[model samples]
Target: METFDLSRLTDFDFEAVCKDLFEEELGVRLELFAAGADGGVDLRHLSSAGESLVVQCKHWHRSGRAKLIEHVENTEAAKVAKLKPQRYILATSASLTKGAKDKLFEILQPYVKTPSDIYGKEEIDALLRKRDHIVRRHLRLWLTSASVLNSLLAKNVVTRSQALAEEFDGTLRTYAVNPSYDRALELLESRHVCVIAGIPGIGKTTLSQVLSAHYMAMGYELVEISEDSDEANHLWNDELNQVYYYDDFLGQTTFDEKLAKNEDSRLLSLMKRVSRSPNKRFILTTREYILAQARQRYERLDRHSFDVHTCVIDLSDYTYQARASILYNHVYNSPLPQTVKQSFAEKRVYRPIIQHRNFNPRIIAVTLAESGLLSGHHESLSDDIVANLEDPYRIWDHIVRNQLGETDVKLLKLILTFMSDIRLDDLQELWMELGEPLRELRKALGVLDGTMLRSMHQYGAVHVGFHNPSVRDFLVNYVQSDIGEVTSLISMVRRFEQLETLWLIFPAPGGGPMAETYKRRRDQLEQVASMVFHAEPVNLRNSRHGKNYVRRAWLCLEMGLDLESEVIRELALEAASDADTILNASESTDLHAFFQTLARHKTSRGEEIMFDCISWAVEWIMGDLSDWNLIEEAEDFLRSIEHYDPGIEVSEALARLDSVRDDYAESAFEDWAQTHRDPVFSGSEMKEVIDHYKAIGSTDPFDMSEYDNVLQRLDEYDAGHETPFAAPRKDSAAGLAWNEVREVQSMMQTLRESSD
Candidate 1:
């Protein structure tokens, strides 16, 4: 008897296997964590759907489900028994014995409300999808097993190459979110280990995305080095078939162990391959920190595989072209909003809050966006970039030189935390909460709120969200060495204010709270509310070029554009068709307003709002959906996504299974056959047998061929007859529908009982 060993598997291969398989069959995805199996469950799926099934893969050499019954008690012990999935599916690569099955069934029988034969699958499915889905996806990702003992040794690691190639090609579609040009030539020609570093929110990722698209356009066979998967390892050993991407390598660290392997590490291996291959091109994107790790080498084929290279493009100051792009990319390209359009033409001297720093299109875009000064925002050559930009190096050096005290660090945290747009009044309470010295708080606060932080701060107070999206990431990483005692203090403040929203404010879902606040704050508000009198959109619907701005306005609001609730929501709905599916609702400032706009669009556009409806359904599945109507629409939208996946037929079957035969199922099945492919019958011979059974009304059919065979079943149609299982009554809607032969069993059972 050998023991099972799953620890031999890597996270990536196991998770991918589970994601594609378990979710397909069970609608549950599992996530596997590296450490700490709670109780006996090594994998988990967090779900709201009340039904959960604790699955135990019985790896027993020879087993009984009666022995498996021990795991059932585990689910109950964990207090998840009630929400337990309908079937305690004892899935195994092993077989079960009849005696063991009987014992397990006996144990579960006491808890069973009705015979398993009579149960409606609806309750089970709802719980699986609605409540247990997240947990399932998570668990599958974590615990899906591969048979290592029988695993084949690779003659050539072809699968990794293929998967990587697929992943690389797949990123081309993502270019819709971020665009690039001639990326292959750029990477291939770069002379040194080119560094492309930008401040946070500076669109470095965009540059990488664009570069991928460029290589694809130039006939380069693209290979995506999956962050850390066995498949990726195999990819390195097999082929340097094409250009490879080390894109976002630093973004996730969990895969670092796999990446560290020498030959197994795809990036290092690809580097060697390309250095040797003729005219080879390789593209890499990393934050400067990761970039620092390499020898900053140039010219390869070091059995080192480097190719024709040029100097890395160090794009400085939002070049006029970049500023123009900021203006153009974010503004209305369609039916433009007039009021929003006019403001961009106003020639105000563009002074960067973080002046004189190297600027990217995003910083300029975000600043103009956050300030709600889109149209009036202007650029000037005379504007001093060097003077205005806070030299982060200099500021940190100064603080370090002064032996920056506790107050200085605490004040720095508060300032950075609230750099977006909170009031001085808000800061006062935060100040006391942290218990920092007042003078120190005030002094650092001034610098942070001042030009010292540059474009970092909007108008002193934080933008007011879960955290400062832009700088919070910066502070967490960089402040570890400098700005002493900062992150620990910031973490404490964050505990006091779990979310960055106002403590007193609690807006209800729809409209009441916001409308009330509108009246109360209409007069006294200082930041954005003050600007209500003259709201100018970054995008306008009027001019030829500005027509796009109106559409752009909606996108801006979606991507953290600060705007009045009504304006942003309306804009979002107006151009919702073009919005990215990945656009999150949490990013929206006023969710209700966005929903209201959705409601209005639903009312006005009806079926034309397909894309928005699809977006809503995806959001719905993620548990972010609120409206009941949204759920209804999601059912319809599922039909739409159905068109995209081959599995739609199965989903439709599942949907049909949801109903007890009613006019809906009849109509649904009609529509399904009319609109999509139909389900498969058992077999030609079984089908013929079923037809014969149908021909002789109230006649007995032969016992089903096999235990798993449906035709072999002999459940009684009515209770008067005794059988192994009860026959299904016509679902409340669909009348009893067992074949006529099943009815004969009922009559026979009745006759036998009467004679007794």
Candidate 2:
């Protein structure tokens, strides 16, 4: 008979095994109590034929014989005496000596029918062998076949899976296992091909690994993606049940059609084969957008081919409970002190974390990890989480500013401009541009090997890019400073110039946007607005730099940075004449200051540039006709521009702005009065509202029927349905929002009755 390894059983599993063993071996049905709180009795056999017995189990596989005897005597004895059953029995997984058994009998003499009733490791092992099915049922977790282990080893899946599992082992212990895991298992069991799709970092890959580990532990052969496609073809001869895992199999974050044709087709072929073969399962993960792109570009990889077999779970489906549990897992397992961990586990602490806009598993893990590093910052930790949540670049900003060496920082900046398509040779050239020796360049590249830059096989050769898209995103937005006469902004601008050289140096090939080179070019332009706005103002004395500033100024305006864009606009105009004026300008430059410089223009070219600056400013200000001050500001700039070269375009545009501003102001007030029916406007405020329309050379031309609802509400108030001085919206539940409605109705009535 084979001996059982009771040490391999979890505490819960041990209790379960005991329940089954007693029912099967003794032919006595047993009742189990709640697991951890099972006070003393784990199994109860209640029947007239069996004299009502209570069995207590000690799953102390690691305890010494002396400790086991002590527990049986003191704890088990007291509980058995309290229960006062007709017979008492103690069961334990501990291997006991003769002296220990004698001591336990002496301790429990009064409680049990006999000391022989106590069953130790030998008896339990005998029961396990007599009922072999019981052992198999309870100890299945340890029953993996040697062939499955060999298969995992052959594919090198053992090492990689172990590393990934350990990375999350601590956190997974606390993770309230998501229901989707079971749902995924069921789908894969029936269909054999499960595609777990979601946004990046939303647990697709994590879920895949979890399922992979689960099925692998269930004695399935593990087949993984290989560099050689021939290995997938060899899997056709497999006889055992197989589980194949291909993470990011379709593509990384987004799909590239060329890569789909060259590489992903092999995986697709393997999946098709798996669908037809018995006892085979295929599990893959991809970003939702990437999957969509793949389906569109590669017809052979059509999702319709495996329609019912696919399962998609996304962030949108995560409930508050699920999100909170995910956060709790990381926070509980974080390396923070015990007290800190307890505080973080509090409902109040994690409540905000779940409700936060950036609440996701990836962010939760990163935030908790970063929080541990930022000691004594509990008060501001939530705020910091919010800031970094809004802009994930902040996390990267923290890393780059604090972690990277000087050479690494320079290399990172150059690589950011290159985006993901950064070539080794180009990196060498860009690194050399810093005037560093060839040896120093090689040393810098060596340092970046595993941290940020990674090797990617594409375009028929190996190339280097960011390890992931997030790293590139962070590095591109991040700016580091050094103590120097020049601002870091000017240095960043020079970097952009270097990026321009890359385009001429290596023109991108024609393809879709997902292509690496195309993405790099796209990211360069995409980051320009943020880069310019984030950088400090540079003295634009040179005409070329002035043009550059002017270009960015317009781009900022287009980006809805109205106030900042205008500030840069005026600075660029001043820098055209004297760059010192830009450095001299105060933070709060008024509308008069904006036009004052235009009056001092000497040459027509200078006047033209200044006029163009004023024109752009007025256009932006007048774009939104609601700002009363912008109309007055445009009037002032128009008056100043007349002294230089005020043409029909300027005069007509200014006249149009004046007309629109007056009309917009009157209409805006009317709309405000209608929306805000509050009766809080003082007598002077009402008179001011009337006089304001008159000053704009227009009467209150709005129709009074729009106030019908407010009038009806006022009638309700006057009819004593509500008090005149009732609290705001006191009758709201009664369907009368009297405060604002009454107020607006009174104002409109007073305006019509009162003469202007």
Candidate 3:
């Protein structure tokens, strides 16, 4: 008999768990009321005999038995008398003795009927033991069970899964189990693969963590793949039950070099293998936009139709109740003083936060964790929360500018130069090249770890990267706003990849805001072009190769730099005339870009060189249309040179590529038919799970009427507003900027005096 620490649940969570537990124990459907002014009725049921039965829940475990009796006698007895129900039942998380039940019965008279009608902590735990489904339904209860936590602690000792298990252990306390968790679990259970895709800060990674934890609790070995699918493949064990997690599998911001190294094909292969294996499970997460980009760029990935196994976590998945629970859990578990927590209970300070349009789980967590950072802002804690929610970017802005030291900021800027994680040794080398002391770099990394940056050890090397994509997004916005910052980044460039980062930031002339910023700073922009022209070219695999000159020429042209200049044109011609240099390049985008730059230049020699390169590319592509890479490269080359009247040979190659693609598509369909099957939990069992969920009613623990009213207004506002995601206006009471510092300090002093 496993007993849960019911103390882990919030007052509202406790109410919900009790509702489910009693529904099973009593075999009667109960209607739950809103949080406030329930008229001494937390739940009610009308018997077939027309008897009214009311149940009151008091989660006073911390208040002790004496306090519980006093509250029921002084406050609740009068309210119960007014209702005058035929039967009364009292439920509490507190452990009540027989004497206390008698005292309650004596207070309520005939309405109480019997002392057994009162369910205390002991009775509730016994009910939970008999009704296990109810316990499982409320994820907060089972996930925090002592057994599960102990399992997580034990698993944390394994090197392969230590980081992720530790992360899950820390986050499980505040995690609100929304519908996404169940959906992801079903997909992984059925298909053995689930790709979680969503916008940044939408709980994609968090959902993956929860799913991983679930499998871990079920006696599955956890393998976290940090870099690529090769790690998953290398660690594959058929005799063991294992769950593999690959966070941001595709790329964090852009198509990382890993994908360029043909990892997409390998990843697709691993997905196919996992789909056919019952003992293996794979979970991958990527930003929705990044996944979209990968599908468009990698033909094999697009053809595989990852959408079939993808569980996209969107804002719609979070209902009002779910949002409230998320916010409540964070606040309840935070280290805030008792007074500050009490302030949240006054006048429903949570109402505006629950209804905020930018209500993201990440934003909510950060606001609570970093609330102390806003002490200097001289606003109430509620105001600070709403302000941060209004503009999500501002959450990191103040932290970066005000709190970070000079060394920390520089280190962050250095990390920003790479699209994905940088090797610790490589980052240190770059740090030294930038004239920073090695000791300062270590200190900076230590300061930023677990806050703005994270370091992971894997594959015999330590890799450091941003803690989340939002940090990188913030740094990009930060640097683009300042011309000095942009020029400094260009001046500090040590690798061609860093230059590629700058090119992505200040893309061609039409790129939205950053392009405009670059256009305004033409001198700095020209310096970026000059740096690319003079810098040593490095290949995609991080090695020196002659083909890099072609990449450099292509990059300069894409930056809208004039390749027609005598010196620049000479370099372009020199790279283009070497047919071997163009033919050896792996990426078709690189080749297309180089030739496009040559054709745009339009010199007699450049045109002749471009024609030779296209002819050679067509021949190479025609030799092998079996692989999607070659077929895609052929299609891309033909499209790039179409304006130049690419001759009949190019048309012939495209026709052949089309035939190959059709065959591949048909073969892929056949493969899918052979592998895909109905979900393991489909039919009766799944319906039972869903029906049970619906019976539990709305999970919202707040005032139901108020929550519904606010949701209706939000819908109405969305209909008329151009930007539906805009933050709503706070109520007058919530908008007031009370002195939070004084309140916190005063509360601390009072607590100290009470202790004395």
Candidate 4:
């Protein structure tokens, strides 16, 4: 078929061809009119503001191939002609052939027509695909007309879609588990606000996002509203409220803590407004239990014949399908052993697929990609780049100190200090027991349970959470200088001991630990086999109290208490069972259990359980384990507690532990030295840090830095000349956030330096 040029047709048909091409791709429609009628230009285009290049196509396509050249030549001669329109496009259906393209370029070039390469081959083909299409020769003749091509440069036509790049990720799979997927699809197909709730890791949040994305793509308006961000306003102006995701909102707090009720009121009003509209729609995500408890204020979700629905998605059953899905997601994208996947798939050996707390798709992707677990998979695409997710500790630091204004930064330090898969009872008890510094700290941060608490053990419902391990590692390792602390307490203590060992390389600090004096301390430590690890926990005080007796048991266990395994296990059981000290006492129990189980089965009648037997025989002689007394002269009595007095003296105990601070990281010692060294920090920052600490664990405020390993890391890091101002977030309930105040501070610093 020969391509058409506008000149071959009557003005009416030429306008029709232009309209057809414009509407096909740009969704544009234009009107035909005489030259003099003007308003908003001759041709207009629709684009979401700031982006359209609207154009007015003119000239002709017809049997004027020869005369059209004469007209073009004549128009060039009248360079100053006033009759031309402001922006005229001489577009033609016949795409300029490679040969003709050169000739037109020369003839149009000398005249400064700014040749509008506006016509695409597809558009030309579309126009010429039908009957009465202007022939190719006529198309070229029309485009060459001097009246049209000359005035084309100033025009444009913009379309909305072209301006915005597709920012959505497409290759990944997103799924909502069954029964619920079935229910949700019904709700969506009919357009409903679905309220979903379940225990942590049951996939409520993921389902909300996926549903919202799916329906929104299907042309339903969807928004994600939350306490974390004001996404609710996104749907406010719409009369056609289609679907919405209000995530993690519980009823407003009765009191003003971190969030004021005013914002909640505003949100409530917005939700109501959306509901009142005949076309309003939404999906509410919150602890339904909490919502149900609230006295009815806003309309009940089921108020209508109800386009809305409510459902709880619990994963307790772990149906084979769900288990398989979870397993595939984990190992398919994880760095686990190949046999792990094989075992899971074969179903020959039942392997309990441990669900990582980070059940979101991104984390799953990261876990799989980083572990290179997809290596043997028969069908799996190579993983996308693994994003370095923000470290939860660092984000938490931003939250508590930067956002919340509770600068003591204790709650985070407490968590960082006392961690390792912990039981829920032990966690709560420690929060209640040793909460001297952390008590107020926890309340201030609003860790009020639920989202902040997580289950670490295979859900006997026993829980433990200290942020994701990766986030914690980031704070302690990647941004060490910024945090100036490792959240891991044991690690901090080891580092401190290391620093002290290094300092020991120098002559004992003046009169301190005179080579012989410190050596005696070393000898005393050596006398106890548990001290073999250099961190031997031996009770030096008289063993009078039950707690001290347990400590002695722990010491024996650590020292290869072969004979005393049963005794230690029995004793450690109470401590472990004592919700108050389990987190801080689990190591002893685990060590005790290991030996006790071994001794019970392996001890032949003639073979002696030396360590266990000795400890038990000794315990028999001491009628009361807590009956140890201390001599008045003992200044440092933590060790002597079991042998002498078990009670810890407030200041004196701190002073001795203060001395031990030298054994930690040099940075810690330096932070302590410089902090106390600065008369003010000792009076304030140090006081606050410790007070917050004591609130979390029941230790003295001053003793906070002593007890929390992370605090020591932060201190050492601070003393090491790292940025001490930033700390971990105290609460993970809200997504960690940071904004301009600090950025501007940094900016000013830069500006000031530039001025200098």
Per-model TM-score, in order, reads 0.27, 0.47, 0.70, 0.27
Which is superior by TM-score, 1 or 2? Answer: 2
Candidate 2, residues 638-672: lDDT per residue as tens digits?
Answer: 55455544656567777797567557545654554
lDDT of 2 at 87: 69
lDDT of 4 at 407: 22
Against the correct fold, how does model 2 do in TM-score? Answer: 0.47
Task: Kindly list the per-residue Cα lDDT of model 4 for residues 1-756, writing each as its tens digit.
Answer: 333333323232233345445554445554432222232122444445533333433333432334434544465324313323322333443335544444544554432244543453335555455422232112222322332222122112111121111111111132313455446545543443466665443566556654554444333444434342244554344333355556555522111011221233344444544433334456666544445533232222223232245567765434444444444434432444544434334322222222322233334433344333223342332121112122323323433444433323433443443323344454454445443454564464454122222333332444454433333333333323332232222222221122222222222333333333333333232332222232422111111112323333343333223333343333433332333332232222222322333243343421233233323322222222121111111211222222322133333444644343323223333465456334322222343334433555634324344545545544553444321121112331011111101221121121111100
Candidate with better lDDT, 3 vs 4: 3
Q: Which digits, one per residue and each the tens of the lDDT, describe model 1 over residues 82-185?
A: 43545443333223455445554555543333333111122222333443332223221111212211111122332233333333232221112111233333
Which regions in candidate 3 have their CA more than 4 angstroms from the true location? 1-8, 26-129, 144-161, 179-193, 218-220, 239-242, 255-258, 276-281, 304-307, 376-379, 438-443, 509-553, 560-601, 608-756
Judging by lDDT, tell me the better candidate of 1 and 3.
Answer: 3
> In what order do the candidates fall by TM-score, top score first?
3, 2, 4, 1
lDDT of each: 0.34, 0.51, 0.68, 0.35
Please report the candidate that would top lDDT against the real structure. 3
Model 4 per-residue lDDT at 155: 18
Higher-TM-score candidate of 1 and 3: 3
Question: Whose lDDT is higher: candidate 1's or candidate 2's?
Answer: 2
Task: In model 3, state the lDDT of residue 491.
Answer: 74
